[model samples]
Target: MDLTEQPTFAFDVFSKACPSRGTLEHVTGRWGALTLGALYEGSFRFNELRRRVDGVSEKMLSQTLHALERDGLVHREAQPTNPPRVDYELTPLGREVAERLLSLIHFVQGHMDGILEARERYDTARGGR
Candidate 1:
């Protein structure tokens, strides 16, 4: 009966349930990372996002935008004009995540040689050299 001795869970503010696994999947998603990176440059419309992230299908880009918006990491604006212009930007929270992701990209680019060497070693070990 020593409830005070138990540790509190930050994720279980409402109850004992932890954060949903979908959260992780959303953040680490293939297009999600790239979307954040693209948005970091500035606000862009849907087509612009699609253009910046080459090879991303329209459906996938839409899904990624929805997920980011749901997570409060992205801001979506729609104008009721003749053509109806919509733009997407990063929220402050998103900027934090984007900066971290940018740093990761820089790190990977800087260490690409080491990564290539490691891949070569693995390929040789697998007799695929």
Candidate 2:
């Protein structure tokens, strides 16, 4: 933890002032979700992550990884080499949340057909174009 950053021992996400809201947003948002899911497979460097997550621009992926790293969900390691190398992987806390996210994704995938059919029915009834 940085000396400039204060510690929050207790937090309430329902409250607008809670820091957890920002953390939750980082973990659950589009790029965050995909990044964590990809890292769950194995460690990856910057370009590899850019490839694994389709359509995520360099800036967006970097921002997402930065947020996750700040939140203690991802570990960034810098290695000493001629050119230097950095790799990212899930911390223990990160692995816990990644597993949960993967389970939620699987659950949604299992019901996708049903969800699509329901959406079609609703659209038809509502005269959607």
Candidate 3:
């Protein structure tokens, strides 16, 4: 290894202590996923994002944005104004992650009928428990 060369780390999400696990959680959690998907459409102000991500409370959205921002997946911009304005958008890395997540989202949505059917079958077999 060259003295001045940076060391590279192999991050494995399956490892309990791996930092990537935390980031993966942040990217895939309910609020995190919704927040990222909404931002993927475009930049949005706080309230706008709250509305777009429907069901996410103001507190959850705020926390999700903070986590994503810390993970380098979200960019937060604040402007000085009469009432103060802030916008959230995906960083380049975030866009890439969102693209992959959207693929999975679409797949799940497309298969929802089958998924529901499977659930119905499972419930029926279990006597609706």
Candidate 4:
């Protein structure tokens, strides 16, 4: 397989055709979304964030925080101490995005009952009952 021999897809990740794809990926990554949502509450230490976001491993949390920091969406501070506590919080830009994310979360929570009911109905219907 040589270069330029593969089929081309609709999206040109090389050319950066779409603006939202990268942002969407960053915001909805395995740990990115959870990180943003958690930071919405307030600044939290690494352990606190890990505990708050269930199922997230320490490495993933660290990677997510680093990515968010590089993107300027998160601020990381290290305290001067023997253990050297580290905390993360959203920047102004990050806060704006977090607000939007909160709204989306609220919308989902509000409709969860209806969604569950719909799912149950769908399952029953598909079961041929």
Indicate which candidate wins on lDDT: 2
C-alpha lDDT of candidate 2 relative to the true structure:
0.94
In model 4, which residue pairs have backbone atoms overlapping below 3 Å? none
Using all chains and alpha carbons, the TM-scores for the candidates as numbered come to 0.84, 0.88, 0.91, 0.78
lDDT of 4 by residue, 35-84 (tens): 99999899999999999999999998998888888888999999999989
Better of 1 and 3 by lDDT: 3
TM-score of 2: 0.88
TM-score-wise, the better of 3 and 4 is 3
For model 2, how does the per-residue alpha-carbon lDDT over 26-110 read when each residue is reduced to its tens digit? 9999999989999999999999999999999999999999999999999999899869899999999999999999999889999
Which should have the higher TM-score, number 2 or number 4? 2
The collision pairs in model 1 are none
> lDDT (CA) for every model shown?
0.88, 0.94, 0.93, 0.87
Clashes of 4: 0
Which regions of candidate 2 fall more than 4 Å away from where they truly are?
1-9
After superposition, which runs of candidate 4 have C-alpha atoms over 4 Å from their true positions? 1-20
Candidate 3 residue lDDT tens string, 1-129: 898885666876767999999999999999998889889999999999999998999899989999999999999999999799998999999999999999989999999999999999999999996
Q: For model 2, what is the alpha-carbon lDDT of residue 28?
A: 94
The digit string of per-residue lDDT tens for model 1 on 1-129 reads 587676755564345455645655676688988899999999999999999999999999999999999988999999999899999999999999899888988899999999999999999999985
Model 2 weakest 10-residue run by lDDT: 5-14
Please give the RMSD to the true structure for each candidate, in Å.
5.9, 7.2, 6.3, 8.5
**Candidate 1: segments with Cα more than 4 A from true spot:** 1-9, 12-17
